[model samples]
Target: MRHAVTLLCLLVLAACARVPGPFEHDPSRDYYARPRTDKAEVAISPPRNMPPQMGQRVAATLAMELQSYGIVATVAPADAPIQVDGVMSTRDADLSIEVQVDWRVVGRPRTDEPATVKTRARPEDYAEQSERLISRMAQQAAPRVATLVGKPPNFIPRAPGQVAAGITIPYEFPSDPAADGTAAAAAAAAATGTTPTTAPVPTKPAEQQIKVLVAPVTGAPSDGNRQLYSGMRRALGSSKIVIVDGAGEDVFTVVGAVNLTPIDDRTGKLVVKWVLKDPAGKIVGDIEQSNPVPLAAARGSWAGFGDIVASAASEGVLELLEKAINRPR
Candidate 1:
């Protein structure tokens, strides 16, 4: 009897097995299928009165795949999640069951970036394709969540003797504030009482070797161009940036140029072509890359050139260092 029942089940499957060929939508031939996902926690909701079987199957597979990729999904009883029904459409040809199942993955967006889940595919392509789609969706979504919640702590970076703007900072200048003051009153007071007047030495400005010659930048704005390197160092939490003056023992040098490029007919951004040259002026490293910056909507400003240059320089140096350190021996 069990053998007969097994034979009957086989016959049923054989009958249902479509002879692969071009199959069109047949409203009269439509049949309701069962939910594919059998797991109790995943809630699979299908489009209303259409057919839940195909959708349920698709949804279950999707939920399972999402779960595999670290998303939480569950299969539960009917009347579960009441999301809008997704439309399932199909076009079939010999050896193919081209099914488009449009449904939402079980949760919110990646990066908290909202996305409306719409999926289409060949259902006959084995369960892997659907699961693969779910995997991809979840993979994409995870980063967005991480980004929204994983921002690093705020750090108040300060220069070697510099203080942040709003707070009182302990300044560590020379101990002799009385006579070292550049003001005329302090100078005259020292000179008044035979106060062993020795010309006070001027403390040197803090210097970090730029170790590079990025630009002579001889166009409309020169000093502004130089400020790019200066500003970048500040942003990178490094005061070690020094402007090259041709007399540093650090023989390694990175020379570069920033060009303005047209993003579209009306706008442009900066690009840098950098060369790393040894003391003998032989180029060791050469490359070209773009630097993206936020442009102010104001019609004429370089349109926010100051912030762009600073950001560009910071990124370029950071890239150079990362490459330099990570290069295989």
Candidate 2:
């Protein structure tokens, strides 16, 4: 079975070498369409165990980060259903600070677990980088908070016959010329009133494995491109799908692009698009994620932010690959 699968993959690679082109939408296909959930509104309470000014800064940054995920967030005191409270502590020796936040939806059962975020700053730059540190902490906490309060992202459902016992590739192979020739020879013998030669029959059909190549993310801020790329690779690796480092052995390729458009002076809309293509360079489909983000939160290094975005988008990318593999021959 292993040797048969290997031979099948080699045959696929040798059959096509076309590069992919720009995205073209197919209105007829609804593979990427999923029902959107209603947006949630959240209010951030003042931080405890910190100076009033610093606490307010933390609250404000947290609000901004939540807003980026399409949640209506505010630091001002409000009558929102979801309330978030943060308790903070700083260690002077290491110049590190940790913030533990509890998210509660009014009238709902609350758990003891609080989402914790921590960041460290250089001693020499501590005073000057206070805002940066706060931003980092907020970025880390936003995803957790959003998950608790905001509506969850759409999940792609697995197609029929997809849940096999092991790693089964869903690809369909091309017609075998030898099989066709055998049938033709049998027909000729029958017409001539002669006995036909026996042909060997396989007990099971050969299986072909599919490999995907993930390209570097483009148009992201700071080191976001590399960060997103690494995050995507990690996400794909955790799944049943096989990921290839080089394009030479891949059956499909994935490319990501980021676009940031300013909504106002303080906030911007961040759009991340993941495009999947076959070996022939035809666009299989695309997954897009967009939200309003504070300019301050996205202006600097996207250290942790990239991973968060990539993790969320990988689900849809895998779905696209599945569709391609299971597509009719």
Best by lDDT: 2
lDDT for each candidate structure: 0.36, 0.57
Query: Where does candidate 2 clash, by residue pair?
Result: 19-281, 20-281
Model 1: per-residue Cα lDDT over 185-276, one tens digit each: 55676779634444666665543323543333322122233333333323333323433324344544655455655566533454545455
Best by TM-score: 2
Task: Count clashing residue pairs per candidate.
Answer: 18, 2
Q: Which tens-of-lDDT digit does each residue in 199-304 have in candidate 2?
A: 7754445554567778878997645676577557546644634555456534688899989889888666777888888888889888877666555455444444
Candidate 2 TM-score, C-alpha based = 0.39
